[model samples]
Target: MGVDFDWVILGILAAFIAYSLLTKAVDRSLLTLPIIFMGVGYLVSDPLRAAAPPEILSEGKRLLAEFTLVLVLFADASHVRFSQLKQNWQLPGRMLLIGLPLSLIFGTLAVYLISPEGGIAMALLTAALLSPTDAALGQAVVSSPDVPERLSETINVESGLNDGLVLPVVLLGAILASAGVSDANTDGLAIAALIQIVLGPLAGIAVGWSVARLLDLAQTRQLIAESAEGVVFVATAFAAYVFAEVIGGNGFIAAFVGGMVFGNTYRHHIRFIREFMDGAGQLLTMTSFLVFGALLLPDGIEHATASAVIIAVLFLTVVRMAAIWLSLLGTGLKIKEKLFLGWFGPRGLASILFTLIIMDEYVFANADELLACVSMTVAFSILAHGLSSTPLARRIGKT
Candidate 1:
């Protein structure tokens, strides 16, 4: 495993320019940045892998993926305005509350049925890991003028919040999968999980509230420069994650909770956070996909099984669609609207990050099969959702 720094750097630059130049065309068509970057990485994986240090390839990619997720989680959470959501909260609320759990249940059952040998833990781990949706994968649908405001906002909010909501279950599944491999004590794991859940939010609140206050006072006194706000935004996210981790709590949860607090409390400065996400956040996300193609996807495909592909198909289609459809049953949305919402739940960045976490931090007896299933699902999503988003959104808008 080699890290081709020059190729990676040069490719990123070229892809950035190319994508930027044709941004409108790509948005209007069935193409997305993730698709292009991932395809490029896949096409040149051999050369990229051949030219790098093995250690850096392994650890560096994992860290890059993790930090990307942390930033995404925080930024996404910070964008939510609770006050504005008061009017249209029911749709996303139902999806997060009802649909998310149902997707996990359906996905778990499907994985378990397909690979009974992997056991309930493995099935649960796979299900939980794939539960979160990445709206960026289908940005055209979410950002399209053709899409109704209610529909687009619902999708955006659901995607923004679901990843953080599912992080605990993902972590629990990881622990259980690890325990299955190593005879870890169930009671101790239970205790640790409880503490993690409780303490993570506490740390987040502390960091977020404190930072919000500091920023507020600074702004009031005209002490902090406007240009420095972006730096503060990112630093706050890292502070929350690291603070939680140092205290044995969940870093991801802390980052999200902290972001929620910071965003809501310091609502006036939210623009800076958005700007950071638009630039740094987008770069990190695209880099993750490229790294996935060059590194993770190859190994996942190599370990792919017939059962893995089947599970991936089921997760993307039946599990997700059914969950969304059922959750929106009483919302008075038409059949077409429900189906449209159901189909766009593309699994991308969050799934990739969760899979990378499982690969880096835990040992699973069924690691290869598990990873292959996740990779295939994300790859399928990039194509299926990315291509369908523009056309479907336009069709829905017309209706």
Candidate 2:
């Protein structure tokens, strides 16, 4: 079969690149990359969308989402400041330990109330899927000089680690639900989850440690080139992810663990490496958002009830904020600061990727509902978070 879709992909990429360039030309604008890319993707796909195969679009979206996430996860985790983490452990500690679990609970409750059609298993799956935050979605806040370093650092660390930590829950939920879900059987999911959660970190440690040692050796021997130094970090990240998945481990966890280990061990090399991959990941993120807009948004809106949309808005506002309030009770942060932290837990890449795994597994029971909820929540997030980030940053930065 002669595939012409390659041309379509290239065209979309080129157009977005140009759009991004033009956006960069105009300074101090509310137009975010996600909004622009999403609008374009939606516009183009609206015409010729049905001409594309569902599987192909779905698979392509999943791959793009996966690549974006793996890169971002590694980059985010590797940049964590251990010294700061040591000092400010109370902040991130409260977030990951308390805030994360509460968010999971809130997600479950939200799903249960909003999507009454989905089974308990499905509710659990959706909850697990949305439990983790996406730092990439709020990159402005994290990367900005204006934002308080402590707050951004805490959020970044939470985003970097929570997704990996929640990996097993997402898998286990999917597995338990598989029995009644179309042709899926719940035979090996538990074992799969166990192996993945355990082995992913082991693989990451091996890859990250070995690469750090190798980089050091190369530096001592003067074997490193200017351009190729970046490759070492990139290669290590891809290696950790691919190796873990090849061995049936959780690649995302492997990448996250690998990034964390690499950053902590070889702190010197990571800044340059992160800079290189951050740019690449941004491009990938743009494309992922575009693809999501074109395909997933339409599907989400179609399948979603007005009630589901309302629940999604509520999920973004009340559910996450409440989780933050509870988690930060004793942190001594001002009410405004707590609210700032709460409002910024924007969901993006990881949630979408987790939801897509359901489709990849051909999950059949209330799959539509699950997909709808995931899509609606994420789409709402990309818009709401993207829009609010700048003004909120200005407001919070002043404090």
Candidate 3:
């Protein structure tokens, strides 16, 4: 059989160049990229053309989203300064303890009231999935050194940590909702969840620390080459993920914790590793946005009901703001700072990943409704928050 190898290679190259060009445009107009790509997907889909295979679109989108989240979780965690985190642990602590749970509770109640077709458990699952904010999605806000270091650090740390912290809740909620609370294997699930949560960090620390020490020794012996350092960095992250998953731990958590431990333990090597992983992670994140546009958006839009739209809006604005307001009450932050921090907690990768995991692992009674709810919420967040992030940060700085 003759293969059209040249045509395939040319097409791949062309697509990459086109995507790179699109990235420049995306930087200029943050709101346009997702909206345009989404429109392209909708226009090109089977509804518009009967010849298009739906599964091709579906599978491609799902895979891109999964990989994107993994890279983002790792990169975000790696950039966190462990020393700074030590000094300001209270911010993240309050966020995980006070803000996150309240967000879930309020989100669940809001979904229940808004989604007439969704049950209580399903509502909670939806809430749990959307509870954690994504710092990567709103880099403008979280990365602004113009903002108070304390505020930025708090949001950054919370965004990095809360995503991992909320994984067990999402898993538990999905299990209870999908398998039926009575029939669910809570004991086994709980044990597995605990192991995944606890072991993920331990595995990351052990692997990252050991590798850092080995690299240090290798450098002392003049055995470590410049190129090999990059390889070691990638290997550390990959090993952390694979080993944790092999033991039924959370790979995302492992990647994050591993990156953190590696960053801390191997501060000298971090410049090399962080740059490579971050570039790789950005590529993955962009691919994710494309897939999200192509696959999730179209289906989510078709399934979107009035209830779904209302819930998405409420979750993005009212529910989240309320939870943040309550969480920051005694923290002594100014009113402007509180509002700025609260409004900027954009939900992105973690929600997308958790939703994908739920779909893969369990069959919810209202799968479509749950998916629709999460998808709409995420889409809104990416757009609404992406557009306002820069301006909002500037405004906060002025105030």
Candidate 4:
């Protein structure tokens, strides 16, 4: 049966609607839907005697992953409350300052020792890619009213900010790995990276604040319609991204900063915008997982050596848990709170995006190994953390 473009679109839409309805009746495991859809994609793509060709699926997977990440980064940042962040600054402060760097160091060392084939540069790149936690991966913990609000907020804030935080490290590492660290242009590239990091958020704040003020003025003058508010929110996010990039800033950082500033400045407008984007973000996220299943998983698994797989598993489990434990040291959170936060630092969307960005750079001669490490780690996290998030949160809640 030949399928037209409209038919294909309609089929996907119907499948998603049916999947959504089914999820209502099931236990709603985090990895469950992703695993299911991935299986579906795999089965469809597999011929009796041969695998589906890469050319058939690679572009679609890449585009879906990128779009999902853009929406997810914006939505996650938009949910942050600057006031709340200020009041409960200790947890996030320690996590970013101490926990993050420690995690990167530990992860790099772990990768280095475990994957001797992947040298220090590849090891460090893998570490940077996996260091940032995926907030959406552990939604049950962060979103739960039962979880200690401080702990929950800290994780949420950390996840929202860290992806942007790690961008400079990743970029610097890429440049160093691609061009020897001692190259003459390294200093210039470092300066450029610093500018991107600093100016990205600054541009975002300016554009976001201006847009928020304009929207408020329009609302006061009764010049804006309720129906058009959603469009305005998206336009503001896109403008932040475009303007930041035009000036050599990180567009992802701008999206996040734009969302944060907009969230703070237009508190009343956020609920509507967030609700609209939340649905869209979830859909994009699901599509990302499906693509992961169909494209990255099989290829990553096939390319992954024993050492790479071992490192990926260890990073998701021991390395992450250890970093969380140490990071929470001076915060005075209860052991239970600390442990829950530690184990739940699941890597997800951000890792995937970082992998894509690095893949584009063609930095590592061992790009295949690097991509394999990243893909395996992220895939494992989607299963391991997703399965455990709900039960673990409930257990901690009881304590």
Candidate 5:
């Protein structure tokens, strides 16, 4: 019914055609799909932006980004084998419990130093926004045939769990960053965080267990539909998120936990679900980037200051690497392995959604600056990590 919709449809179609033509060339080069979509989004945005105005478009972009993440969280947790999680649990455990918090702490300090005038809350908001990593950003790193299985699995699980784990922190920071954030509102936010963290996993376990039992019954009776097979699996993924949100829990965390439980409880059925996601995931991930380039990144660039640009680069390099290195120090990992892990923490969809939540839900004096820093950070991450993914993976694999 509006302008941005038509433009996005055509733009994606055109991008696909161009992608088809350039597929071989891109595969042979350092160019990633995100880089292409983002470039196209920036180019076509001015004329094609929605007639509904700024706020509606921003909300639409946020929802698209959120949906992309929902699918990713569900798929990632479900895909990895239980054996892998049990064996390498310590790496990701230390990562989620120790490394992520350190990154936020160091990132907050760095941002506060960079912009002491922006206040502690603003710095916290910026660091919290930037802390989570995006596995999708470095698809080659996680999904490549050449990469070591344990290494890829480690990154996959770490990224999958971190997005949900970091939500409470981001929500707290956002509330504090709000202009008139009161003690009462802060108390309410803390309560919500507690519900999200605790209930999200519990609800996920309940839903995922239920879904597994239902699917088992269908399979035992040979009642599973051929035409609806994919749809059934897709429903399984969304069911976890919907169920959690309905019960005052965090949908993202539910999606991740539901996938883990669903996958393990019905390991035999995972293949069908993975097939469905493999087909749909690329489309969704690309669409999010396209919308990001056209709708979100431009606004971010408009608001960017020199300070934001510097902080963004610092995040991709110093902030993430230092945290990963410190956390992995006594884990028996080598210096190169540690550096490789550190260098690959690219920020993507999760960061976009977090920033959008701020823009939508709350108003702050330094909101523009916070978003600008996030936007710039993700944009740089796409390029820096995308180009380096293949080359670094090859080097690491050889090691």
Candidate 6:
């Protein structure tokens, strides 16, 4: 019943090649890259389990999840133009500032009442984990010509920024959950988190600016190969993340801020950098989803209870929609537009990464149930959002 690692690699290779060929067609249909890979992973989970030990598999998952998130945050943030952001920051700003906090509050309340097994700390933790939206999940809509530019940009920007913005909250949640919020040194934790947040961006700026200057000198002196820029670019991301972590800062935030600084500073080379990173990112993303389906999803599904399922449903729909709708009140968007924005807040990579972080770092009385709820929400989001994206993007494009 054992599957060899060679066979597993071959299978993944074949699946990726086939998917690449059918990518355009798949994009046109309701099926998505995540759905496809997740299914493939689920189907092969048993065989893979026979091949790898639990600890090895867990470590593999952690590395894959972390690297995937690092690249994603970096790439996404790099694409955001500061000038454009300044011009259109209103919509995303409101969502991040007003909508995000409301979502956290509402999500915590919902979890507290609906899934009381985890207590308030777990409730807050879960809420913080799920609050950030995933741009990868909404790629269809954001990239679609049919969707309004402003709308797509708003969603894109929100996704790019919110994960970094909320990382502290997630850290706080874990600290509080471990110590029990009442017994925890809440003030000290807050100060520590605040310091990490501040230091992350500072490290990012230093890495980004230094790297950009080096690249500029190299290019000017014709000392570096065009092909090698990609290597440097990827290295910069890792460097920013590692440097930040070394300085007791949040790596993800450093990656994001580094990307922003890199993108802005290395303007002439952005296209080359993105071309290389995008291909790599796509591969990492697909592999991460595959691992998720094979391991995380199964575990979550197995441990999920009735309350977990209920909370999952509410978090995706009621909690998300209400927070979005309320945040856009004075923006004068039509009901359909508001709903469109609300509905597309799909949970994917960030949530998955946060769940992994919880599994690794935190000890919750209701850890299994907490992850189950988040996992269920992510699964539902993958299907619901994937199926709806293309058609909805088309529908909204006409309006």
Which candidate should be chosen as best, given lDDT against the real structure? Answer: 1
Q: How many steric clashes does model 2 contain?
A: 0
Colliding residue pairs in candidate 6: none
lDDT of 5 by residue, 131-216 (tens): 98988778888987777886787788888778767777887787778744443244476677788778888888998888888887
Shift in Å, residue 259, candidate 5: 2.0
Query: lDDT per prediction?
Result: 0.88, 0.79, 0.73, 0.75, 0.81, 0.86
- Candidate 5 lDDT at 341 equals 86
Off by over 4 Å in 2: 1-11, 23-27, 48-51
lDDT digits (tens) for residues 271-371 of candidate 2: 67666855765678777777777887788878998766776777788888998899999878999999988988888878877676656864657776777
Model 6: lDDT equals: 0.86
RMSD in angstroms, candidate 5?
Answer: 2.8
Worst 10 residues of 1 by lDDT: 181-190
For 43-111, candidate 4 gives per-residue lDDT tens digits of: 443331133345545555666655665566666677778787778888887888888888899998998
TM-score of each: 0.96, 0.92, 0.85, 0.88, 0.90, 0.94
RMSD to the true structure for each prediction, in A, is: 1.9, 2.6, 3.9, 3.4, 2.8, 2.3
Put down candidate 6 lDDT per residue, 1-399, tens digits, no spaces. 568977987887899999999998998788999899989988888878888788998899988878877887887787778888788888888998999999999999999998776778889999998888887887899899999899998999899888877777898888778776344355576677778889999999999889988888889889998889888888999999999999988888899899888888874657766687568778888898898899888889899888888888888899999999999999989999999999999998889987886678666677788778888998899999998899999999998
* lDDT tens per residue, model 1, 1-399: 556579766876797788878887976666788898788778767877777778978888889977888889889998888888787889999999999999999999999988999899889999998889999998989989999998899899999999999999998888888888854455587788888898999999999989998999999999999999999988999999999989988889999999888888884647888888788787787788888788878988999989989998998889999999999998999999998888889999999998888678877889999889988999989989888888898899999
lDDT of 3 by residue, 1-399 (tens): 433435533543465467667775666565533444444444444332243345754565566655655656665667677687678877667777888889999999988888746578888889999888987667777777667778887888889778867777787787678656445455576677778888888887888778878888888789978878778877777788888888878777888788777677764646775576556655555555555655666678888988889988988888887888888888888988878878878877788777876787776778888778888998888888888877777777777
The parts of candidate 3 lying over 4 Å away from their true place are 1-62, 181-191
Query: Which sequence of candidate numbers ranks them by lDDT, best first?
Result: 1, 6, 5, 2, 4, 3
Residue 209 accuracy (lDDT) in model 4: 90
Q: Please give the lDDT score at residue 339 for candidate 4.
A: 78
lDDT of 2 at 306: 79
